[model samples]
Target: MATARHARPKELENASLEEIMDRYVARYADRRADWAAFEDAKIEGYKRAQHRFIGAGGSGKHNDVSAIPAGNFTLSIMYVPPGQGNAAHTHEVEEVFFVLQGHLDVFVQDEDGRKISKRLGPWECISCPAGVIHGYDNNSLEPVYFQVMLGRGKPETMGYADDDLYKRRDEHLKAVS
Candidate 1:
């Protein structure tokens, strides 16, 4: 009478404890720093790096074999330098940012482009709903480190506010390795 949700996967069910741990555990030192910018970040002011830990974490690197397999969501550590940030964009699923260090000026916008900004320091967080345009800036003197998560294990590429960027959103996909 056990349901699939409660059943152990065949791959893990027969594996040794060490094998299970090897497949599930992701060490921080082994993570790769991927700076594969999204379409909008190709602009002069927007740039950042993503250290993938689980799934692609919305960077569209779904083929990254080194990352721990994601179940329901994706996770990554974002590094944003001073005066740099992401442009307004939206995804098919909700996105969350939990600031781990430095200050990030985050904002969310309505359909008409009306936006509200807030300064988030360490331990602060924000959840941007699906289809809402949101972004962040590192106005502080130092770089900002933050954890990012997306609702889906492999969400679609984000939709940029700018027509050009939106049109080229999938360009980053081809460049991802």
Candidate 2:
């Protein structure tokens, strides 16, 4: 949900209605496909492609000029293959996962390492609050497509719960660049 504290990009602050519509629109055909978007995406269980829409979500591709300049939030469409998902991660702002296709197993973990998961089918969604350890998996026999939204336009990248992965969090940027 958008808030009253939104910050409009400079280009949109005083643009004509036509220009605003043109620049603000994000089309599925124009999404940027980035596999290996996060540190865990380099691991077997976390292999998925991040299709950038608004900003780069939490993928750390902050300079992705092709994306619409975000205002207080970011959005991306994730393409998760069967048997793949992401490592548990926490962020400074809330993150929403809305399933668009296929079944996804979304989970949030306790400090003691226990995790609770629920299966989300098409049109289902979950909003993981800030600082919560959470992630999702495509445990079904097919691939899955879901939309992810972060509560900040240029927020810090995710904090992985796994020490090794956390240490190499910025490596994804190096690999992609």
Candidate 3:
């Protein structure tokens, strides 16, 4: 007697074409910016928002869910207004930033507090190693846009390199609370 062939799962077999298509496509208009992740206008810098398309980055917020589920990495776009950017922070996984528009000044600081900065124009990219404290700044008058990809799907909260900045952030949170 011949055995029956294995059948596909019911969910997969019953899924509509549109459902499958939607899972693979993500439009820019459909994305929303999460402003709560970075700056609050209290600090001199650190005013940026992230648009997630692959996964919720290290922001520790589930607000942004990408159309494509992240397996080994997370992808997101960051919008940094002129003169504003993220503060120096370290991650356990590798983080890369690809400049899409305007100019960005990427900087990394060593444990001894020495910092090295680089300028990245459109189509430029920078990859920061794990546990390195790095940050970005848009010194130009025009706004800067960049794509950020972390090695891990679910990254941990960023560890600020500047003790003063961390303390100030904590104090600000306390005041608001």
Candidate 4:
């Protein structure tokens, strides 16, 4: 049995078969990745990919009818190759990472530059509050997979914590263009 916190809309309950099917189904094959946005072999050492199933994520791409648009939050899966991870960045909205496979080390940096990190195994989860500078790394030899849930339907752009890395990313883009 399933329950909803709020009553279901009469219109939705009475929707046509095709409309109902379209509203509820999302297939894995339809997923697309913005590999160039984050993973550039020359700019960064790690190769991380984000698969948007629910929303376009903070990058602002792939927000089409094909994707299940998020109303209050966004959900996506991340594929991180061994020895690959994300650069330190901050988000205006809360961000959560739930480990589904392999090992991951999540690091958090405070305003004063003090940093701390923790390791997450399968089925583990960690939440970084709004405006917290955090990043993830896969230290294991095996690839790591995790689900990312953001607090907002359309999150603001991520703020890179390291100024040098941010500048480097901009320069790299300019050079490639």
| Residue-level lDDT tens digits of model 2 in 79-101 | 99999999999999999999999
* lDDT (10s digit) by residue, model 3, range 68-166: 666688888899999898778888999999999999999999889899999999999999999988988999999998999989977766667777655
Candidate 2 vs candidate 3: which has greater lDDT?
2
lDDT of 1 by residue, 1-177 (tens): 845567577667778878778877888799877776466666666888888888987778788787888888999999898999998899899999999999999999887889999999999999999988999999899999999999999888888887888888888878654
Per-residue lDDT of candidate 4, residues 12-72 (tens digit): 7667869877875778677765465452334455577778777756544534466786777
Worst 10 residues of 3 by lDDT: 168-177
lDDT of 4: 0.75
Q: Local distance difference test, per candidate?
A: 0.86, 0.90, 0.77, 0.75
User: How far in Å is the alpha carbon of 155 misplaced in model 2?
Assistant: 1.4
Best by TM-score: 1
Clashing pairs in 4: none
Error of 4 at 112 (Å): 3.6
Model 2 worst lDDT window (10 residues)? 2-11
- How much is 61 displaced in model 3, in angstroms? 1.6
What's every prediction's RMSD, in angstroms? 2.9, 4.0, 5.3, 4.3
